[model samples]
Target: MSLLALTAFAAAATASVPVHSVALDHRGGTYKVDYRAAVETRARTIGMSAGTRPSTQRCIMTATVSVDRIIADGGHELHARVPGEKTFTRNLPGDCRGRAEQLTALVEDRQPAIGAHLAAAAASDRQHALAAIDAAHNLASN
Candidate 1:
C-alpha cells in the first residue's frame, strides 16, 4: 500500500473510534461522567452515588466507575471489568466495550483532582454557613 493510502486508512480508523469527554455540570449543579470506549471495555460509566454532590457541604462524594463488555449476537450479558461483578449483566450494544486499563487510569487520574477541588469548596461553604449562624445570633441578641 502506498504511504498516502496508509495514512488515509489510519485517519479513518482513528475517526471511527469515540473519544472520552468528562466535565462538571457547573451551571446546572450536577455531577455527570462521560467516557469513550476504553482499550478493553466499552460504555465506560463514571458516576457518584445518587443525591450526593461532589461539593455538597459536609459530605465527600465518591466516584464510581465501571467498564462493561456487551455480549454479542442477540445476547444480554454485560460484563464488568472494574466493578468486579457488581454490575448486573444487561443488554448492551457491541460497540460499547473498549479498554479496561484506560478507563481505570482515567478514573484514578480524575478522582484525586476532583476530590481536592470539592474539598476546598466544601470547606468554604461550611465557613459561610457558620458565619450566617453567628450573624443571626448576634442580630437576635441585639
Candidate 2:
C-alpha cells in the first residue's frame, strides 16, 4: 500500500471516540420522618415465628443521587441509587427464608422513602442553582 494511503488508514483507525463528561450537582436536605416508620413496619410485617429465638442482625442502607447538567437545554437531570446490606443468623432453614423475605420487604417498603429523599435533595440543588442565578443577575445589574 502507498505510504499516504497507509497513513490515512492508520489515522482513521486511531481516531479517538468522542467522550462525554458528567458532573453531579448534589444538595443537602432533610428527608421525611415517615420513611423510618415504613421501614419499621416492614420489619414487623416480616416478623419471625413463635419460639424462633430472636437473632441479632446488622443492616445498612446507602443512597446516592446524581444530577446532570444539560448545557444546551439549560436544565438539570436527577438520578438516584439505593443499596443495602444485611447480616443475620437463624436456627431453621425455613426461618432463614423468612429472614430473607423480611429483608426484601424492608427494602421494598423503604423504596418510596428513598425516592422522596432523592427528590428533596434534587429540589434543594435546584434552589441552589436559582440562588446562584439570582446572585449573578443582581451583580450584573449593579
Candidates in order, TM-scores: namely 0.23, 0.26
Per-residue C-alpha lDDT of model 1 across residues 7-110, encoded as one tens digit per residue = 43333333323323233333233322222232221222233334554521221112232332222122222222222211111222222223333333444455
lDDT tens digits by residue: candidate 2, 1-142: 2455334433332232121232333224222111111121111123334566764433322212222322111332222222332222222223221344444443444455545554454445554444444454477689
Which TM-score value belongs to model 2?
0.26
Candidate 1, TM-score vs. the true structure? 0.23
Give the RMSD in angstroms, all C-alphas superposed, for model 1: 23.1
Give candidate 1 regions above 4 Å deviation: 1-96, 128-142
How far residue 2's Cα lies from its native spot in candidate 1, in Å, is 39
Per TM-score, the best of the predicted structures is: 2
On a 0 to 100 scale, what is the lDDT of residue 88 in model 2? 23
